[model samples]
Target: MKKKIWVNIAFQVGALVLALLSTTLLLLAAGAPPFQAYAAILKGAFGSAGSLETLLITWSPLLLTTAGVLITFSAGLWNIGVEGQMAMGAIFTTWMLRLLQETSLPPALTIVLGILAGIVGGALWAGLAGALKTFGGVNEIFGGLGLNFVSTALTIYLVFGPWKRPGVGSMSGTEPFDRSLWLPTLPDTELSLWSLTLSLLALVIIIVLLRGTHFGLRLKAVGKNPKSAFLMGVPTWQYSMLAFLLCGALVGLAGAIQVTGVYHRLLPNISSGYGFLGLLVSMLVNYQAVWVAPVAFFFAAVNVGSIQLQLMYKLDSSFSGVMQSLLVLLVLLGEGARQRFLRKH
Candidate 1:
């Protein structure tokens, strides 16, 4: 246990170093001082209320998506379907909003319905992978991936078909939702405390579920050794499906929050790679649910910082992606080395 903890910590440090090195490379490549670029990113992401608001906006989706990934990961399942889940969630919420526009339901109730639609939408899409894993003998990774393409195509078709607004593929999406259904934002910041609160709630629930329940124990058992777990009478497939369902619901909530809080309409790139970033965050945090929060905030800062880096240093934003990839690779490698060292000792 001590060696495992040390290895995890070492991996995290390696990731941070890798990230810094990449940023420095980008700065040098652009013929700018790396320190100056770093300063700019920091300033741009948190210099004022507006910058902080942008950071919060960026933080929301990553936080929620990471939390979602944690569910399946805890159960030793790989769920790469969060991007598709998010898209479907937004699409479902938007469709429901349009369908219920003429109803006399209270605005609050309408908003609730939209959120529910998102949750249901994400679950169905993710549940298919779980089902395929259980019965069709398909791998969740490939299955979720294929479904992602389908989900994207479906969204495009919907916007161009019956759901199309006056201008198809325009930013406003199928139609502008009524103001009543929109999530209220804080006056002091563009950030919606309500949505942020939802993320916090998810984090708490996941921690409680994963570390404090029979379901969580079963999931850990499955993750550690499915055959042994099965022999011990654990229903591995059922647990896997449950994990997927929980993941979908969490990711769906993230999508709904984004639609209701930030964009107010579906953008084709609405997910904006936040799902993937969340994955990186989860890995860097060593799959510790509590650690995800701080790691997510750090990632959010860097992401927002990259926007500033591009604007101020005239550097490409791809620098952030490069840094993130390097971090993930180095961290993984470090973990491997640390484990090897432990074995030798």
Candidate 2:
């Protein structure tokens, strides 16, 4: 176990170094000093209180949504549909807001409704994959991938049709949510305290559930050896569905938090592809909950800091995403190599 962990760590470090090198190459292409660009990237990520705030703002959603992915991954399910689930979550919450637009309820209560609505939306989207895998005899990867397009189309439809803001472009969305329904902000910080707390609580709950429960053990078994588990009388399909539902709910929570805490309004492109970026984080950390925190924060830093890199060294801001993707690919390749080397010995 120790050896395996060390291997994972080594691969993680190697991938990070390669990511940095890739960024440096981009800097050189732009006729800038690579070292200076690197330093500036670091400085922008953590150089001041303002930078820290920006990092946290980005970190909030990444952390929550990645943790959601970690849940299904633990059960050996690839829920690539988190993007759609998140979109549905936003759709549900926004619709809830619109429905109650005329209600004179307290902002707190309406906020709760929006959050719950998001949870339901996400769970429903994720549930479709579970259903397909269980009854339709479909592979989850393709099912989830297909669902993402559907959800994106649904989001666009809502914005352009029923949810269109009055007198605005037909391709746009509804009026901004009520100010009272906004998520409370952390004192002296752009971060949302409620959202952060919910994510932290989710991390703790998932850790305990996965590490200390019979259900977790069975879930692990289903992932490691599905046939064997089924022969042993474990209801693999049921457990898999359970996993999908949990993943959906968590992803939905992420969407709800995004709208309430950060956006305060819906957009067709509201997601920023954070759900996709989260997949890279999960793989990089080897699905370890503790490691997800830092890995996500670092990714968020790079994402936010890349703006400075663009300005200082003429680097394209897209460099950060390319770096993240490369890191995930390298880690997987390195792991495969290590396993092959062991088999040879």
Task: Summing lDDT over every window of 10 consecutive residues in candidate 1, give the lowest-scoring window.
Answer: 167-176
Candidate 2 segments exceeding 4 Å error: 1-12, 170-173, 187-189
lDDT of 2 at 36: 78
On the 0 to 100 scale, the lDDT of residue 21 in model 2 is 79
lDDT of 1 at 248: 90
lDDT of each: 0.83, 0.83
**Residue-level lDDT tens digits of model 2 in 1-345:** 898788767866786687677766866887888887767878989999988888888887788778888878888998888898898888888888777768897788888999899999999999998899999988889999999999888888877777777765454455677677789887777678888888778877777777789988898888888899999999988989999998899888888887888887777876678888888899888788778888899999989877897887667889788777877887788778777886585
Candidate 1 lDDT, 172-244, residue by residue in tens: 4666677777888787666888888888888889989888999889998998899999999998888888889
TM-score winner among the candidates?
Answer: 1
For the record, the alpha-carbon RMSD of candidate 2 to the native fold, in angstroms, is 2.1
